[model samples]
Target: MTAHQNGTISAEVSDFLLNCFVRSPSWQLWLSLPLSLLLLLAMGANTTLLITIRLEASLHEPMYYLLSIISLLDLVVCLTVIPKVLAIFWFDLKSISFFACFLQMYIMNCFLSMESGTFMIMAYDRYVAICHPLRYPSIITDQFVAKAVIFILARNGLLTVPIPILSSQLHYCRGNVIENCICANMSVSRISCNDITINRLYQFACGWTLLGSDLILIFFSYTFILRAVLRLKAQGAVAKALSTCGSHFILILFFSTILLVFVLTLVAKKKVSPDVPVLLNVLHHVVPAALNPIVYGVRTQEIKQGIQRLLKKGW
Candidate 1:
């Protein structure tokens, strides 16, 4: 072959090989559509429930008010991440720009942290209701609940700022393929060329500190609640008290378990199937968001009745 022809053929071959290597799996893209639809339905249901409660004057109690706030947060969480995720999956766009990716990571962390804080606050609210029935009104006043909600938003929102800022400083080399569905902190961290010792340290410190604090507070609250329940002379009173706290306790355990598993799984170096990790990622976010509305709405008679009434009115 002539030298010019040989050179042109070699260049063409290289371009083709590069494109082949860069292509992502089509199945992953297909999966995102149905998942996005599911999330959309869940968000819609949650919003409807929140609106129903808000419109009804009788449902304006502190507990329901806090729940409405949680539903708002859940809607934000779902809306913020799912659309972009669906786009990425459907378009087969494996790579995200640094800034966009950072934003996604930040918002996800913010909402997740907010959810955790809300759960802890809910536990405290329940504790007061069950353990200090006489002073429940005084202890968990409307003003106190408002302040708690504000604090939950402020504290968790600020906590996530550092993660994205710190992560943005790290350099990523050519091999930046993410294994999971979203651009999660750990997954992005794995692609960095610079030493991630600080990142890893920060994760461990933050993860355990937040988790430990929440767990301790929840445990203490429930302990007092249990003690108070035991002292109740009437079986019906005991049952009612236990029922009120039962769903929240189960949700707390569920959140703690999945979070612990996700963090631990990120620490490992072994190759995991992308599907498994992606499914877990969906569960980690969706379950907690969807669970709050379902559990509270189902378990609380006032909320259920309010929703039913609203529905009957064509709301």
Candidate 2:
């Protein structure tokens, strides 16, 4: 439990301090109300969507399966970050055990990467569906879906595990005050007394490699999709094509926009208040999770019909 000389710090490094942006204690509890609402909405929406997808056998396509995976990741992301965040905000519980902090950090990193990977799989699904509809049936088959799942899990899990590992290997001799709501990698790493260049570079590399590549490929996918659609040159064809990608584009847009904003906020942290980046980081987890199912699940015709049938049976 003590120092490993080049590895771990002394066992005295017990807990890390988790910080948030609650101005006044009494008024801060009020902020939890909105956050609670978001959590409820997100969890409820994703759960209901999962049940709908499960019960409705007609929704057994690879696209829907991928959508279900997205919902599942959303659940994991929200659960990992938000509840502890609420506890911090409402109950003044700012101290997270060393192990717990690392676990949270790991989950956050793994699932964020997973979420991005899932989106890429999803975009590829869309690309095949639109760009090569005739081959889509064979391209996005059961085996394909299974492989996509494996890739998403394996890539993100393998790459992201290093982030928390690298962070944990550092010595935390300094005070463990994390200047954010969640146990983010950079937040936790910045508290270390040791040099954080490797930690910073690795995080940067992972972000650009995982998220950047996903975004680039997804962008190319939709670009090709749009090109294919425009080449149709028929009346109402553009609208029809846009409609298919509309929901996905919206969800992916929100996903990328929030992440970009978070990165920008991190850079401009000096210009703005510290709480802004922290708040953005916290919101990035919830807002996407909350909206993912709503945009992809409820808006999809089959899922919508399934929900309607469920409600009709209930009523």
For model 1, where is the 10-residue window of minimal lDDT? Answer: 11-20
For each candidate in the order shown, give its overall lDDT on alpha carbons: 0.71, 0.85
Candidate 2: regions farther than 4 A off: 1-11, 22-30
Residue 5's lDDT in candidate 1: 39
Instruction: Evaluate candidate 1 by giving its C-alpha RMSD to the native, one decimal.
Output: 6.2
lDDT of 2 by residue, 169-215 (tens): 98876667787788888888888788999999999999899999999
For the record, the alpha-carbon RMSD of candidate 2 to the native fold, in angstroms, is 3.3
lDDT of 1 by residue, 134-232 (tens): 999898888998899888778777766788787777765424456556767776777667788887777667656665677788889999999999999
lDDT of 2 at 157: 92
Q: In model 1, which regions exceed 4 Å deviation?
A: 1-34, 264-275
Model 2 poorest ten-residue lDDT run: 22-31
Kindly report which residue pairs in candidate 2 clash with one another. none
* Residue pairs clashing, model 1: none
